[model samples]
Structure formats: structure tokens, C-alpha cells
Target: MTMMSLSWSLVSIANKKQQQIRRFKITIHRLFGFAFLCSISFFLFSPKIPRSPNYHQFADMRNLLGVPNTLNVITNFPFLVVGVLGLILALEGGFFTISSQAEISTWILFYAGILGVAFGSVYYHMKPDNNRVLWDTLPMMVAYSSLFSSLVVERIGQRIGLGCMCALLFAAFTCIVYERIYDDIRLCLMFQLILPLAIAAVAYMYPSNYTHSTYWFSSIGIYLLAKLEAVSDKKLYRANNYVISGHSLEHVCLALIPFLLSVMLICRERKFKRLGDLKDQL
Candidate 1:
């Protein structure tokens, strides 16, 4: 073939390949969107989950230094420390350069929520009642929703991310309200389950803009460990000779998540200058 014809053939092949990649990315986006919708539908249709009568009981009841559930309650102090430190860092512009004001605000909220968890959880463990449980779980929902928003902002558009953040916060509060009025926790539980899945899916489907995306995965791993610890609370307490419970360690693991995320923000540099770069390239 002539040089001109060969060049044209090569260009055509490249164009086809580009189109295929676009189609694949679009397909993945649609799949994630479908999964999100299904999660919402399930939350709307599922029966209300009643609070267990035994939910207030914890394996570690040892009073230490005049505090009940001392380890579980005190281990949460790291959350407050991390949260306040994160907020200060954000306020002082300690994160990677190019983070916008809105992004900083989201970080602040996430940290503040962590701080609230510290106080609220301490109060809940003091009494172990449903009313106090609201205080504990409400702040957690805030932290979870803000983290979701932060990830969305990093991987998607800022406007879209902010909108999703607002929606998620509203959903989170609604769960609390629904539980208070109806004494059911289905929506709250669903929110907890769905948000992590959404975060994971977004991380998987979208290209990372920062160098330390692996930190997100690490945070998720830590979160899963916390959940496992929480579920195996009694077993872990017994195994440890009643010195500390899995629930307490769960708090410690959870506290690490925000700290790791802050480290990511502080240490990682951007791979892209704009959202368009993510779409047009990776």
C-alpha cells in the first residue's frame, strides 16, 4: 500500500480502539449506576429491622479507673485526636496542593464526624441504651457519607460529588429519623452496607487521580477488619482473656482509616490537573 493509505489505515484502527474503550467505560458506569439504583430500591422495599434486645450487651464489662467498658470507651479517643488533627491540617492547607476549598470542607466534615463519634460512642457505652446508640451511630453515618463524598470528588466531578454528598447526608439523617419514629433500623443498616459497596465500586471503576490510591484500599481493608472485630466481639474478648474486646479493637482499627486517608491526602500528588484528563485518558 502507498504511505498515505497506510497512515490512514493506522489512524482508522486507532479510532476503532478508542471507541471500544469508551464503550467499555460507559458499560461499567452503567453497571455501577444500576447497582446503586437496586440498593436504593431494596432499602425502600425491605421490611424494617427491629433492634435486638441484646444489642446493648458487650463482652467487656470490666470497670477500670471508675469507667465501665473502659477499653472500648477509651480506645475511641484516637478518633477524636485524628479527627481534630485532620481538621487542623486541612485548615492549615497541609494536604496536597490543588485541593479546592470544597474538598477541604469535606475533609473537615469527615474529621468532625470522627470527633463526634469519639464523644457519642463514649456516652453510648456508658449507658448502652438505644437513645445513646443514636448518638454513637449518627456521627458514624456522617463520617461514612463524607468519606463517600470525598472519594466521589476525587474520582468524579466536583459538582457531582458535592451533590452526592448532600444526598448521602440526607439519607443518613433520614435513617436516624426513621429509626427514632418507627424503632426500626433497616434504612440505617442498608445505608451502612450500601455506602462501602459504592465506595469500592467507584474506586474500582474510576481511575485514580492521586498517587496514593492504594491508601484507599488499605483504609477499606482496615474497615473490613473493624467490622469483623465488631461481629466477633465476644469471641475476641474471651480469646484475649477478657483484657480487651474485639469491639474495642474495632474502634482502634476504625480510627486508623481517617488517619490513613489524611496521610494519603498529605503525601499524594495529583496525576491529572482536571477531571477531563481522567475521562480523555485513563
Candidate 2:
């Protein structure tokens, strides 16, 4: 009887520990959500950020084989490659280890956005001007929105993920429209930065359901590198002796993100499940 009572005491302690851990996780998640809302509120209420007058100007303005901004135009082909391949594998279902329609659908939207990037970016590079810039920015913003939504679906539940996705989609659309009408890119730029930061935050704070989460981390690193390349386009072009520009390299770096995620989908397995544990606790 004494041995049995001691065992019971240990079991009680473990259960209480699990309960405390669960509550702590919930509190942390809520705090992160609140902080995000505050940051977004600041962006919405802040002043307008206008697109630069020289936004169309890109480094490496070479016209090779009758192609204007040849490197820039050619670089977009990587988006088409990964976008199409990712869409195909995602649609086939069996090709990836995905277990639910929700995630599959999110991936479909993400790949679709990537494909749009290919066409929109190509068109914009062919004749970059204020008039054509909308096509370029819109598709990329859509891709970013889809990316953030995909990570939400992975870390959070399906219902909340889907809801956030619709909200984010609407946010992306509104920002683009605002940019076009008011000639302001502030909201759009903020969302771009916010989404990636949120991605890293979620990855760090939330427990992942699937394996290969390191891919997401590495992808974000790739994104930062791409952004740096984009900002230093002229310096990179001069450094490379006019062979290739940083903007072109940026496209390549950005394209690697989707490819990395796609590889994750193909390789990852469902690791742990909370449903059974919760049911047992109840």
C-alpha cells in the first residue's frame, strides 16, 4: 500500500507539471498576439510612406539579346520553376506527407502566389515604371501573405489558421490598393517586414507539429540576405564588375525560400500529437 501511494504521488506531480506547462504556453502565445496587434495598430495609424521616384531604376540595366533588364527578367524564371513544381507536388497529395486538406489548400495558395510572382516580376522588369510597378509589388505581397498564413496553419489550429489567412489576404489587398491610390508604400512595406518577423517569432515561440522546422528558420535567414542584396544592388553590381547585380541575386535568394519549404514538406513527418494527451487529461 505504501509503494502504491508513493507511485500515485509521483503521477500526481507529473500531471500537475504538465498542466502548468500548458498554461504557460497559452499565456506566452496570448502575449505575442497582443504585441503583434499593437505593432500593427501603430503601422495603420502612422503617416504615409511614399514609393521612391526612382523605384523603377534597377542595377544592371543591360540589354542582352534584345531583352531589357535581361538579368532581372531572366532571374524570375526560378520562381516559375519552384512555383510550378511545388504546386504540382502539393496537388498530387501523396507526394507530400501532409495529413489534412487545410494545409494542402494553404500550400496551393502559396504556390499560386509564387507562380504569380514569376509573371508579374517578368512583366515589371521588361518595362519598369510607376505604371507597371503595381504588378510587381502586388504579386510579391500576395506571396508574403500566403507564406505567413502557411506558417500559422502549421503552428496553430486549422480554424484559426484559416481565419487569419482570410484576414491577412484582405490586409494585403487593402495595402496594395492604398499604395496605388495614395502613392504610399508604407503599409505594404510594413506588412512585408512584419510578416517575416512574425514568421520567425511564431517559429521560435510555438511548438511545431511537423519536423524539418529548421528549414523555416534557414529560409528566413535567406530572406534577410535577399533584402540586403536588394538594398545594395548598385554596390554589388560594381563589385561584380557588371556581370550580375544584387537585385538579380536577390530574386534567386528569395526563390530558394519556397524551394526549401517544399523540400521540408517532402521530407518531414508528423512528430507529436496533443489531441490524445488532452483527452487523457480530461
- Which residue ranges in model 1 land beyond 4 Å of their true spot? 1-47, 95-98, 273-282
Clashes of each: 0, 0
What alpha-carbon RMSD in Å does predicted model 2 have with respect to the real structure?
Answer: 5.4
Candidate 1, lDDT over the whole model: 0.81
How well is each residue in 193-250 modelled by candidate 2, as lDDT tens digits?
Answer: 7778877877786767688889989998999999999999999999989889999999
TM-score of 1: 0.83
Lowest summed lDDT window (length 10), candidate 2: 273-282
Predicted model with the maximum lDDT:
2
Where is model 2 more than 4 Å wrong at Cα? 1-47, 273-282
**Residue 54 accuracy (lDDT) in model 2:** 82
- Cα lDDT tens digits, model 1, 200-282, are 86777666767978988898899999999999999999998887898998999999998898888878987634435433543
